[model samples]
Target: MVHKFAIEQGALIEQLPEFIQSHFNMVIDVKADGPCGYHVVAHSLGRGEELEFYSKEYTFSNIHQTLGSIYPTPSEPVGTKHWMSMPSMVEAIANAFESPVFFFSPNLFSIMLPSLLSAQSNSRNIYCISTKYTPFCVLNDEPYEFPAPRYLKNWEKSATKEALGWAQLYSPNFQKAHD
Candidate 1:
């Protein structure tokens, strides 16, 4: 669920950090649904249907091969944990599309960064942005937005005493180490 909208210049004057709120007049809010990550990658690469089918097949094959003996048969509701393997999914997407993958998450940066970095290679370019979510003024019932340029630029500025502080500390060294 990717949503695109425009924000009034000073709509969020008192809410978001000045740096994050000022970077863009337009914004995209990607809802953090179960398949949100996959959808983002597929849509970005312009391989929507193909990626979806590949994901389904890949997940089913991996699950059967890796955990078939343990589970024996499928559970009642079906366990989706194996299906949502981010590292494997991202790797598959990158390889299939033959393009760099950029993952930006408001949280889960620390947990995801190491694996993504280790998986990086001369042929594969994987970038991760772990930052705090900024609330770009509410309009009707739509979800919040994260201004990309502002969020990326925030990496270079002073760390805010909020959720983003830890991200700032980790980002520079993490990027340097990985790159």
Candidate 2:
């Protein structure tokens, strides 16, 4: 849905990796108010921009921890406004949906799931890209996707070790590759 907080995504579209540009057509800007990462997932699922994992009883599984190691408190409680929810909420959704969730940041990314083997067989996978504000872009293609990136951004190129560390936080799979 169109809104004031959506990203313009003009020239930035051209700068995307050739693989991404080839796989999906750039859609309209997703509202950047807050939970835009969730929005992308919902869209990928063909459910439009609505993700309602909260306001239900099942989403509170071991989620009383910090977000990304810096936030003082845990993610917001249920029934909060759409734009007020945090990105980590996707963790609960991924668990509930029994799928893997990818946190795609500017220079780093993370693959989070309860079990790598189980998530690999999941029918529904999630990808969220953290932009300057929130996750505004969604990559929803298969076959062309690779585990280790052939080309990374300038920031990631200089810090491959650091980037792999960020990925290892959620998946021991990264540990094997790094080792």
Candidate 3:
């Protein structure tokens, strides 16, 4: 799919723009490694421009303190684990490309509030991507069966304290994290 997006097929070569077609041909004929994702940076529409992007997977896990604190439920329901969806990934990429923005996953705040506080800058816009149901443990009247003991509303205070130290560190911000 990406190849088609970048280059034309063998028989459809004539349909493509000459410059792009020629570039693709030369790249395939000369370049040793197969199709690698790289920015086609050109300063004067020719060569020597600044363009870079990483196509590697960045894995995230809870920090030690967080793990120890949430000992009772090492793993919560849907939202507890480190899972990045397609839209969140796209938003991160867009933010990275557009401005001096700090993209953080929802769980990171509860886990690394102090570190984030320390690294905070005036110009940086911190964007946290989260879903309502995932991070939020709602005991509404909806028809659903939770696997484990869902933390009742009463346990929220202590649990937040134990798992995140959420209120103590971030306070008002912690409220957002909890939500």
Candidate 4:
């Protein structure tokens, strides 16, 4: 369902950057009900299972085993603070696919600061994206709220460069260790 706020409020989308606007055309509608995050990740990894089945099979069934297997060392633990219980799920997905998980969030540096900071520093292939207009959630059934950065709205300034700088600094280090 499209977020109600996005449809009712034209100003939000109208003020977004051109690049973000262009990307909007390709939006894929995922089922909002149930574990949408898991569904999206599973879909991305080519896992055709539904949310419930995937959660039960991959997450609940063997989360501790998965975590122990990946992060056997005590120095580097596996889990997320803000996203409690999600670290295990993430670890399971990453281990299952043998690929890194990249989480893109507009508020990664802000709202997700605790989780980001407390995340396993040595978790390989887990890239984080902090940028403007990051889709957060569906507000009442209009479209996903793609709120422009506050700096953009107030000063007509784009934080893309700063965001990219942060990503560049962190991503390379994360990838280097893994590679």
Output the lDDT of residue 47, model 1.
42
**How close is every model to the real structure, measured as TM-score?**
0.32, 0.48, 0.17, 0.31
lDDT of 1 by residue, 1-179 (tens): 45443533254332334534343343334344333444444444334423345446444556434433322232242345633344445435544444334343443322222212222222322332223443111111111222222133433243223434333434443454344
Stretches of candidate 2 exceeding 4 Å from the true structure: 2-28, 51-87, 120-122, 148-179
**lDDT, candidate 2, at 82:** 36
Please, what are the lDDT tens digits per residue for candidate 2 over residues 10-110?
44344454434444444445656454554566665556664343223235444423222222223442333434233556555555555556555556555
- Global lDDT of each candidate: 0.36, 0.46, 0.24, 0.34
- The deviation in Å at residue 159 for candidate 2 is 28
Between candidates 1 and 2, name the one with more favorable lDDT. Answer: 2
Selected candidate, larger TM-score, 2 vs 3: 2
Local lDDT at 105 for model 2: 52
Model 2 TM-score relative to the real fold: 0.48
Q: Pick the candidate with the highest TM-score.
A: 2
lDDT score for candidate 3 against the true structure: 0.24
Off by more than 4 A, model 1 = 3-27, 47-88, 104-131, 134-179
Give me the candidate number with maximum lDDT. 2
